[model samples]
Target: MSTTYLNLARKWRSKNFDQIIGQQLSVRMIKNSLYLNHFFPVYLLAGQRGCGKTTTARVFAAAINCANLDAFQKNPRLTSLPCLSCESCKAMEQGNHPDFIEMDAASHTGVDNVRQIIEAASLLPLLGKKKVYLIDEAHMLSKAAFNAFLKILEEPPSSVLFMLATTDDQKIIDTVRSRCFQLFFRAIAQNDLRGLLVEICQKEEIGYDEQGLQLLIRETGGSARDALNLLEQVRFSSDQITEENVLRVLGCISDDQICTVLYHVFSKAKSPQKLIEYVDEIKLESFAPEIVWHRFIVALKIAVWYKYGVSSTGLVLTNDLKASIEAVPLSQAVRLFDFACQQEQLFLKTIDKHLFLSMFWIRLWSMVHNQEAEITSLVTSKSMVTASIDSKLTVTDQLVATSEQQRVTISANSSLWEMFLEQITQVDDQLIVSLFTQAKLKNYDTESNKLEVSFHKKFELFQDLFTKKDAPWFLLLQEVFGNGIQLNPVFESESIVQDVKPIEKKVVDQSKKQFYQSNNSANVSKKDIPLDISDKTAWAMTHALLERFPGTVTEFKEETDE
Candidate 1:
């Protein structure tokens, strides 16, 4: 004779409030309500999936209709409200109680189904003192169905109790929600989950590794049902549940593989070919792309935490892996983390996940390499500037040397500001480049390391863009200038232009007119025209643009009043 096998998840389902893990507050509240006999007409239980919302509803339903409920209510301290020995408790436990109705709102999400529930709720109990209705996934009910339930919920029968369980309570209509007493359930704590797994392993005589169990808990994301289901799968896959077996069962890439990828990502060597080869190897292993990507994201998070000197107790890192993670700067690690997070949805949506991941790896490699080159260049330039400053310093007077150093530092900052402006044109976004170009460098204060940029009153939008801390342009400013440097955005007053001297304005207007006339005249010689300060600045800007873009000037049509 062969006996049938039951999965751990179903076999270990919570039978009572005390048996429900990770929901002490909800259990206690329900127990207290039962003890006081102060039941709400309707109750709303909401939480994440596998966090025991539906299970709590079942337990609460049984407790209310239990034949021995009066005994617990009188005692005030007895937690076993539903004496499972009675006929009512036995019927509920076997899922055959006539008075206890469990409706799946996901399937019967219609007005007619709700009408049937309302009609039945009006009838008296057949097997117990009170009739209990458990509506699972109550948020799945259609809007019309929720409206149909409003009247019955607001004026429910004295002997009828309605319990609604939902993973997302926000979708439930406000009218229905207003009538229900809400109880929220939180995810199981890691320690509580660990203890539950330990007890299950002991009871089932399953051999396991502590690290492997921790990995399971991490993957389950505080879902008890998922944890038990995964545990059963791992148990049957191997004689002993170890980290390697768990990884195999989960179809997740191993930690060593994840570390290898991180090493290539953060290492100084440009090894795109090796990274692609490794990705191909991962694909050959038949690992799930989503799981692989998720593991990579998790590894990046751990690397970021390590980079910031925050120790993660869950992860056990080898010395080499720790060294590799520690070698990466916090900024680079955070960028990689953000990139991985953004790519997750795209990776899952693509049909050819391996191809997408290969491209992703290449892009990530390019980003790291580019950032490394930029940092190296910045460091080299700073060293050269420092050498020049030291070479010019005199040893005769200490105060004079200090003053000279300050002047050189200020000069270097001015050169850095120019470099920043030149680099802005290289950005891929033309709109951002145009906005940045409109900003004038008004002042640079070395004392506060502040760069005050003034925008014309007409460019208020550009000024607002730079003021936002999360804006990409603002972040780029900090990246070019040191993190300590601050940006002060000033908007020039509309009337400020009226303060300019008439003579100076006339000279500027005359210089601009001559410059345009010279460009438009074919008979004029360029050398014969003397250049003013404004003309010199324009020529300098044009030469810089030509040097950076390396293009011929095909057209030079000046703007005119048409």
Candidate 2:
């Protein structure tokens, strides 16, 4: 075969408005204007590559001055159908039209180049009723060139029509864009691209599997030109186009292999070694890690969509594969998807892709498995604790019923301390519970109504906090043991006194000074001090501040001056 043979993209170039793909809005607007013989002096068609902007402009140009345009004006539906036999239409098709001028603004971007077009716009057409100037990549024109052509582009001669096509509309100045009737083109749909590919294969007498054609459509990202070009390459390489051939040619992982990887990753019986084996198999098949990772995410997303009752047409997977993917919890699938995305950017920049991929899989596996194990352990522990607590409450209820016959006496030390722990647990005071766990009930006196507790050297810092005569801990202790009971906190080591001595005196002096000054007295004896409930409540509020503000209360004082 000679290289001179036309490629699929050129061979199947859209000749009329109806033949153009994925440009229905632009086509409808232009065709309606053509039908009414109402032409804009300047028209801007904008979109990405291979989206039919220039082709639509050319077709509209030929249709504007077609020999049989009268027939089209009579029937609105037939306006886009230009007569190919007309002299002007044939010239436009051959790229030799006298009335239809196509200028690539990319190459001719200077003011001199635009000036020529502006000068030519005043002349009369040699071959047709309207002279058309189609400028592709119009955004490439320089600022001076755009400024030079701005006047003529806004309001041109009666016989002249200007058509501009660009991939980026933002690059074009607003003043120039405002003057033109702008229409936007979009990417071709996968379904439409598939149908076009099928028609091309049928016409070219090429054999292609359904999956292979679908893969081509996906790889092209909805570009008709790109799909056709890929199709031509596949056809030239082999007589039969299969999934394996498409994967090999595109350097992508096959859908089956992708399904296999995800199945093992999310399966209940999944093991780390099994996942590693799958990665090795993919590596042996010459698949790039980045492509494999991308395919995994795509397949995982499709499964998630299906799980949520959304459309899953694009994905090609077996029933077993579908079931395996659906077995993954939605939360886990979402988390893995997020993690894979984070790793994707890193994978691209790393020098050792395979090593990076292996590390990523191992990290993901460990995190997922550890999370499942922790959740299971937490549930089991909660259930066991609930059962034990229920059994204990049953016995305590029976004991309470017999309280009149045999009074239940709560000991002032261990038994009362246990009750305090239970009360704080009921109130959800976890910080209090943690501190009490390290304390030891040393003694209790009935005559003086005093209770003493000992703490290890580590808890010496918090001893004075709980030892306050009206602290919340003392209140709870007195309520459980008896009213008027004082709490004496004892440290196990004398060295703790030195460590805590600096702040202890500061707190005592400030509290004593504040209390004495409030009574207008310098001396207040312990016997003369009335231990009223209201006074205890006030001290309790101060201790509450100690717990609230933490380290700041080492030397107690109010935060805001009121």
Evaluated with lDDT, which candidate comes out highest?
1
Task: Tell me the whole-model lDDT of each prediction, alpha carbons only.
Answer: 0.77, 0.73
Top TM-score model:
1
- The positional error of residue 445 in candidate 2, measured at the CA in angstroms, is 44
Off by over 4 Å in 1: 1-5, 280-285, 317-329, 371-562
255-299: candidate 2 lDDT, tens digit per residue: 777677666666646666678887887673366767766776787
- Provide the TM-score for each candidate, comma-separated: 0.68, 0.64
> Candidate 2: which pairs clash?
none
lDDT of 1: 0.77
Which lDDT value does model 1 have at 223?
93
